[model samples]
Target: MQTAQRNSLKLLQWMMAASLALPLALFAFASAMSWISTSEAADQEIQRTLDVAHEHALKVFETIDRSLAEVTEVIRGMSDADIVAREKGLHARLRVVAEALPQVKSVWVFDANGRALVNSLVSPAPDVDFSDRDYFRIPAERDIGTYIGEVLTPRPPYLGARFFSVGRRRNNEDGSFGGVIQASVLPEYFENFYAKIGREPGSFLALIRTDGAVLAHFPVIDHAVRFEPSGPLGRQIVANPLAGARTLQSPADGIERRMRYQRLAEYPIYVSAGLETAAIRSRWVSTVAQHLIFGIPATALLFGLLALAYRRTQRLEEEASRRIEAEEALRHGQRLEALGQLTGGVAHDFNNLLTVIRASVDMLRRQDLPEPRRQRYIDAISNTVNRAAKLTNQLLAFARRQTLKPEVFDASQNVRTLSEMIATLIGSRIEIAAQVPDESCLVNADAGQFETAIINMAVNARDAMDGVGRLTITVRPVNDLPSATTGPPNPHGHVAVSVIDTGVGIPPELFGRIFEPFYTTKEVGHGTGLGLSQVFGFAKQSGGEVTVTSDVGKGTTFTLYLPRVVGEHSPQSLLAEDAPSVDRANASVLIVEDNAEVGKFAADTLTQLGCTCVLVENATHALEELAVDPSRFDLVFTDVVMPGMSGIELAEEIRRQGLDLPIVLASGYSQVLSQQGSGGFELLQKPYSAEQLARLLHKAARSRRLRRDQAPAG
Candidate 1:
C-alpha cells in the first residue's frame, strides 16, 4: 500500500512536468515557423527590391545605349561618303542629323588631313586644325569604336553646351581612313538621364567611361570622377554589361543594401542599383511580428492541453539554427555593395574639387598687373596651381582622360618656340641638341600641349641623369610608318617627334605602368607620378600616337606619331588696301558670361575699348536682348562655356537670322574652339591681358569688313 502511494505521487509529478513542457514546446515550434517564414519572405523581398532597382537602372542605360546606337549609324553612313564630292552633303546630313536626333547636340567630320571638313553647327576658322585629337589617333592600335571624351564645354559649331563625344574613323574604298566622324552629345543629357534614374530617394547611380571619367552620376557627386581598376573596389567594370552587383552595409547609413549591376549592351557603360535593407525586409518583419503575436497566445493554449512537448522543442531549435545561417549570408552581401558605392563617391567628389580649383586658378592669370609684382604673385599662384594641377593630372591619369592631341604642324617652328624654354628646362649640366626640319612639316597636333609634353620629357631626362645628360629632340615626317603596337593605333601619314634621352633607363617592369597615374619610380614629393600621364594625354588629344622604347640601364626614347596634313600649303590672301573697320563707339555689343569676375573684366575692357557694351550673366539674357531687337547689337562677345546657352549657340541663332555682325568667342579652354572651327569668328583665349583683348577686337572689326565683301549678292 505504501509503494503504490509513492508511484501515484511520481506519476502526478511527471504529468505536471509534461503539462509545462507541452506549452513551451508549442511556443518554440510557433516561433520557429514564424522566424523561418519571415526569413524566406525577407530574402524574397530583398531579391524583389534588387530586381526592381536593377530594372530601373537598365532603363536609364538603355536610353544612353540607344543614343550611342544612333551615333553608330551616323558614323557607318559617313564611312561611305566621298571625301571631296560629298563634303557638303556630309555636313548638311550631319546638320539634319543633329536636328533629327534631339539627343545629339553636335556632329563633326575630319578629313584625312586632320582638318575640320564639316561641322553641323558652326564653321571652323580656316586656320583651326584637329590632327591632334585621340578620336583620330587611337584607331591604329585596334578597331575600338565608340570613344567617349572627357567632360568639357563644346567648342564652336557645337557651342552653348558642355558635352562628351564619341568618335569613329571612316575608311576609304582602299581601306585607308577617309576621315573621322565624331558626335558630341551634351553632358547634361547624360546627367539628365541619371537624374531621372535617381528618382529613387537616397539611391545613387554612376556611369563611368572606359577611360575612367564619371560621365554620368546621380546625386551630382562633384561633377566628375577618375577611378582606376586598382581602386578600393580592386577592379572596375570596364567591360560591357558589368559582371555582377553586390550588397553591402553602408558605412554612411549603417543600413544593409542589396545592389545589382549591369553593363549596357551597346555603349561602354555600367549601371548599378542599390535597395535599402529596411525596404527589403520590411514585409518579412511585419509578417513575422503578426505571426508571433497570434502564435504566442495560441501556442500557450495548445501547449497547455498537449501531452508530449519535449519532441517539439527539439524541432524548433533546429529550425532556428538554419534560419540564422541564411541571414548571416544575406548580411555579408550587403557589405560588398556598400564598398563600391563608397569608392566611386569619394573618387568623383575628389576629382571635381580639384578640377574646379585648377580651372579657377588658370582663369585668374588673365588679370593685368605690373611686371615685377605680377610675376611674383603669379609665381606664388603658380605654386599652388601646380599643386592642384599635379593633383588633376594624377586624377586624369587614373581616369584615363589623359590622351593624345595629334595634328600636322611645322616641326621647326615647334622647336624654335621651345628653344628658350628648353634652355631653362634643361639644367646647365645637360646638353640639349635638336634636329628639326627647317620647313614646317605639316604634322597633326596640339603645339602648346606638345611643348609642355617635351618639357616633361626633358625634366624626366634631367632627373634620370641626375642633372647631367644629353637630350635630343628630333622632328621629321615619315612615310608608311608602322602604327604603334602599344595602347592605341596610329593613323596613317604619321609624323614622328622623337625625344631621345641618355640616362638611367626605366626597368622593363615599370614600362607597362609608367604612364599610369600616381605610379612613379621617383621618391614621394619629387614627382606626382603624372609626367608620363601628361605625355599620354597630349599624344591622345592630338590625332597621333605615343610610344616609349627603353633599355634597362641604357636610356629611353619617347616617340609621338602624328598624322600628316595633306594638301598644298597656301598663304592667306592679305588685303594690301585699307579695310573697313566696325565703329566701336557706334556699335552696340552684347556680352554674356556666367562667372562674375570674368563678366566684370569683359564689361570693363569693352567699355574702355570704346564699344557700347551690354553685359548679361547668361545666354538667356543675351538671347532676350536679341529677341527684343535682333539688330540691336553689331557684335557679341560671349563666354563659350556658361551655365546657359553657349556663346557659340548664341552666335548660331544670330547667324540663323543672317545677322552677319562680328561675334568674338572667348574661353580659357581654347582647345574646344580649335576643334569646332568657330571661324571667321575671332577667338580670345582665357587669361588674356588688356593688349590681347584690344588686338582681338581690332582684328574682329577688320574681319567683319572682309566677310561682308565675301558675301554673295542676293
Candidate 2:
C-alpha cells in the first residue's frame, strides 16, 4: 500500500511538469510564426513603396520626353534667316514651355559650333558660346539619339546654377548634325521632388547615368555628381538590367538599404529610390515589440494561474500563490492610479468653471441686486461659459473628434487681425510683435483652431517668462516640409505660422512627451496639459503637421504647417455674402426636436427672432405638421440626431416630396451629418448664439423665396 501511494505522488508530479511544458512549447511556436509573418509583411510594404517610387520616376521621364518632342517640332521648320526673324516668337514659346514645366529651368537651341541661337532666358541672343560645353560636344560627337550630359553650372546669359541638360541633335536633312536643341533642369528641382516623396529619414533618390555618373543626388553630396561605379553595389547596379530592385550597403553612408532602379527608355539616365535597412528593421522590430509586450505579460499570468491551480491540489504552495496575487494586485493599483490622475485633472478643471458659473448665478438671483453689479455678474457668467466651451473644445480636439469648419484664407491677414486681441490677453508685460508678409500666405484650415493654437503657445510662453518676454508671430511659406517621424508630410509650398518666444525653453527630455494629452510640466491647478496636443491634432486634421524646436536656455518656436491653397475665395468674402442685411424677417419655422426642454428653448428663441415656430417631438410629427400646411412654414429647422428618423433623412424625404421650403440641420455632434453631410441644407452647430440663429433664419427665408420664384409656372 505504501509503494502504491509513492508511485501515485510521482505520477502527479510528472503530470504537472508536462502541463507547464505544453504551454511553453505552444508559446514558442506562436512567437516563431508571428516573427515570420511580420518579416513577410515588412518586405511587402518595402516592395510597395519601391513600386510607387518607380511610377513617379517614370512619370517624370515621360513628361520630359513629351516636352522635348514639342521643342524639337518648334525648331524643325526654321532656317538661319528665319531663326533670327522668328527668334522672338521662338524664345517666347520656349519661355512658356519652361514656365509650364517646373522641372525645366531653361530651353535653348545651340549651333553645331556651340554658339547660342534662340534661348528662353534672353531675346536678341547674347554672343555666348557653349562650344566647350559637354551638352553640345557629346551629341555632336556621338551618334546617339539623345545625349544627357553631366550636371554643371553654366556661365552668364543663363542662371549660374547646377543643371543637367538633355540634348537632341538637329539634322541638316542630309543626315548630318546641324545643332543641338537642349533643355536644362535644375538639380534643385529633383532634390525638392525627392525630398517630398522620400518616406524615411535616411532614404535617398538619385538620377545616375548608365556610365555610373550621378547627375543629381537628392540631399546633395559633393562627390555624388561625378560618382564612379567602384563599390560592389555600384558595379552591380551598372551591370544589372535596366530596371529592378536589390538590397545593398551604400558606400557613401555605409548604410545597408533596399534600392529600386528604373532606367528611362527615352534618356540615357536611370532613377533610383532607396530605403535604409535600419528603417525597415526598425519597423519590423516595433511590430514584434508590440506583440511581445502584450504576449509576455499574458503568458506569465497564464503560467502563474496554472501554478496556483497546481499548488491548490498539493495544498503546500499557498505562500507562493499569495505572492503572485500580490504582484498582480500591485500592477492593478498602478493602473488605477494613472486613471485617477487623468480623471482628476479633467474633473478639477470643469469644477473650477462650474464654481464660477454657480457663484455668478447665485449672486444674480439676489432680489435687491444693483444694476451695475448685475451687469458685472452677467459678464462674469458669460466669460465662464466661454471658458468652459473652450475647455470642451480642447478636449474634443485632443480626442480628434472636433468638427472643424475648414476654410481657405490668408493666414497673414488673420494673424494681423488677432495681433491686438493677443496683446490684450497676454498683458502689457509681454511685448507682442507680428511679422506678416505683404503677399498673401493662403492656407486651407480651421481659422479658429489656428487662432487657438497660437494663443495657447503665447500663453505658455508668458508663463515660461513669468509674464515678461517678446512674442513674435510670423507667417511665412515653407519650401519643404520638416522631417518628422510621424504625421503626414506637408505638400510642397506649405504655409507656416510660427509662434516664437524669447523665454525659458523646453527641456530635451520632455520634448517627446509635450504633445501627450494630460502631460504637462506646469504646477498642478495651473494647466490641464492639452494645449500642444490640440495643436498637433489640428495640424494633422488639416493634412499638415506641427513642429517645435527649442534649446535649454534659448527660446522655443512652434510652427503649424498647413497645406498652401493656390487661389480660393477668402472667408471674409463668403461671410459677407451670407451676412444678414437687415433685421430678422417675420417668417414661419418648423422645429423638430426630441428633447422637451431643448424644443421649448428653440421655440422661445425663434419667437424672439420674429418667427412663428411649429414645435414637434419627432420626424413623424414634423411630417404631420408639414402635411397640414406644406406652404405655411418658410423654413424647416430640425435636430440632426433623432429617434425615428434622422434630420438628414427627413430633409431627403421632404426633397423627394418636391417641397421648396429651406431646411436647416442642427446638431451638437452627429455621425450622419459628418459622413453624408447636410445634403445642401444649411448646418447650425449646437449652442449657436441668437445673432447666428437670426442670420441663418434670414438666409433660409431668402433661399425659400428664391426657390419658389425660380419654379416653373404650373
Candidate 3:
C-alpha cells in the first residue's frame, strides 16, 4: 500500500508538468503566427511605398522627355535665319514652352557651328559656345536621334545649379548634321518632388543613368553628382535591367537596406528607392515584443517554479559543465574574431591599392591625352604600384613571413631621411619634430622595415591626436633596460628609436593585447589593426623589442629597441654599398621563371635595360644552359618560389658546381627565402623597378668579377 501511494505521488507531479507546458507551447505557436503575419504586412507596405516612388520618378522623367521633344520639333521647323535673328514670334513660343514645364530649366537652339542662335531666357543671349559641350559633341559625332548628357553646372543667366541635358540632332535641308537642339532640366526639380513624397529618415530616392551616372537624388545635399557605374548599385542594375527588389548593403553608409529599382520606359534613366533594414526590423521586433511581454511573465513563473523544484537534483553537474563550455566558447570566439579582423584588413587595403592602379591604367589608355599628361599618368601608375608593393610588404611583416635583408646602418640617419616624408604623410596639421643624435647609433636590420615601423607608429600617433599634434622622433642609445611590457633587454646593448606624440593615450589594460594581430582600438574602415602587429613583428625579428609608455591625459611614446651594431660605416655608406652603378652593355642575363608571363616580362625588361637575355622555364633548363657554356651568362636572375627546383636549391647547386656566375633571387613573398635565408645570395624583392633591377644586376656582376679575381692563379 505504501508503494502504491509513492507511485500516485510521482504521477501527480508528471500531470502538473504536462498541464503547464501545453499552454506555454500553444502561446509560443500563436506568437510565431502573429509575427509572421506582421512581417508579411510590413514587406507589402514597403513594396507599395517603392511602387509610389517609382511612379513619381517616372512621371518626372516623362515630363522632361515630353518638353524636350516639343522643343526639338519647334526648332527643326524654324529657319536658321529666324533663330539667329531672334524673331519675336519664335522667342515668344520658346519662352511659352519653357514656362509651361516646371522641369525645363532652359531651352536653347544652336547652329551647325555650335553658336547659340536662340534661347528662352535673355532675348539677346550672351555669345556662348555650346560646341564644346558633351550633349552637342556626342549627337554630332554619333548622329544619333537623341542623347542625354551627364550632369553639368549651368552657365550665366541660370543659377549656378547642376542640370542634365536632353538633346536632339538637327539636320540641314541637304541632310547634313546641323548642330543640336538642347533642353536642360534642373536637377533640383526632381529633388524637390522626391522630398514631397514621404519617406523614412535614412531612406533615399535616386535617378541614375543606365550607364551609372547619378542624374539627380533626393536629399540632394548628400548626393554625389557622379557615382561609378561599376559600384554596388550599378552591378545591381546590370543584373536586373527591368524592375526588381533586393536587399543590399549601402557602400556610402554601410547600412543594409531593401531597395526597389525600376528602369524608365521612355528614357535611359533608372530610379531606385531604398528603405533601411533597421526600420523594418524595428517594426517586426515591436510586434514580437508585444506578444512576448504578456506571455513571458506566465512562462517565467511556471519555469521558475519547476526549476526551483529540480535545482538540487542537477546543480553541481550543470555548474561544472557550463563553466567548461563557457571557457571553450570564449576562446573560440576570440580566435574567430582575430581571423575575421586580419582578413578584413588585408582585403580592405588591397582593394584600395587595386582601385588606384586600375584608375591610373585606365587614364593612361586614353589616346588623345597630351604627352606631359601621359607621362604624369605613367608616373602615377608606377608610384601606385610601389605603394601596393609596400602594402604587401607590411602584410608579410605582420605575418612574420618576409625575408629581411638586414644591413648595419645608423638609425638616426634613417629617421632624418624619413622626417620629410612623415610630414607629408601625416599632413600639415601635425608638426614633425625629429631629434637625431649627431653620432650614428648603428643597428643591423632592414632599413625599409625600420622606416615602415616608424611610419606606422607615427600614423597611429597622428590618428590618436585626431590629425593635429606634435610628433617627435628620437634616436638614442640605450645601455640599460628594465624588462616589462616592452620586451627583454638585449645583452649586446640597444638603440632606442622612439616615436612620441601628444595624443590620446592607450589604456593600461590593453597594453598586453596591442601587439596581437588584428587587435585595434580604432573604428571599422578607419584602421586595419595590422600596423602595431607589423611593428611588433619587425622589432622581434630584428633581434630587438618594441615598448610603449603612456599617460591617460598627457601623451604616448612607442620605442623600438634594436640591438646596436658597433660599426664604422655610416648610413650613407651602407646605401652606397647596396646600390651600385649599372653598365648593362654586353651583360647577358639568364632569366629562370616558371610563369610564362613573368619570364617574358623579365626578358623584355632586361633587353630594355641593355642586356642580352636567355629565358628558361625552370632550374633544370637553366642548369643545362649554364652547362653549355657557363661564361655565356654574366648574371642568373631567378624567382625564389618556382616549381621543380626552388631558387635557393639552384643557388646552392651553382655554388656546389663552383660556377663563377652570381645568382640574384627574386620573390614577392617566399617561404623558401624566409626558411633558407637567401643562402648569402643577393635577394631582389619582386615588383622591382627598372632602376632597382639594373642596380642589383650591376652589383651581382661586380661581385662575380671580384670572386674571379680573388681565385688562385688558374
Steric clash count of candidate 1? 49
**Model 3: ten consecutive residues of lowest lDDT:** 569-578
Candidate 1 vs candidate 2, lDDT winner: 2
Tens-digit lDDT string for candidate 3 (1-714):
344444444554674576577766876787678667765665576667667867876776667667767766666666788776655666677788788888877777778878777777867667777788889888888676657788887766557567889788888878788778878888888778777764665566777778877787765664455546777666767788887777777655567877777887757777777667787777667777877787778777776676655454233444555676789999999999999998889898888878877887898889898899888878878878878878887887566677576677878988999999999999999989999889878887788889999999999999999999899999999886546634434555889989999998988998889888788888989998889987877776565778899997778999998878784654442223346557765578899999898889878877887778999999999999999999878899999988889988998899899987878888878566533445445677777777766776666567767777898995
For model 1 the local lDDT of residue 218 reads 50
- For model 2, residues 1-714, the per-residue Cα lDDT tens digits are 344444445555666675667656766676677667755665566556556656766676677668888988877877656777889998999899889888878888877678878888889789888988888887888668767788787787565678888777887767788888888977777777778777566577777887767777756665544435786556676677577767776655666877777776666777777767777667656766776687667767766766666555455444445676799999999999999998998999999989988998999999999999999988888778767767876776555556556566889999999999999998999999999999999876668888898888888888777789899999999876786634444444788889988888998888899988788888999998888877876676566778889986779998988878775555642223255555767889999999988889888887887899999999999999988889888889899899979998999899999987888878766346434544445666665556666776777677777877998999
Considering summed lDDT, which 10 consecutive residues are worst modelled in model 1? Answer: 570-579
Ranking by TM-score: 2, 3, 1
Model 3: which residue pairs collide? none
* Structural similarity to truth (TM-score) of each candidate: 0.33, 0.39, 0.39
Each model's lDDT comes to 0.62, 0.76, 0.77
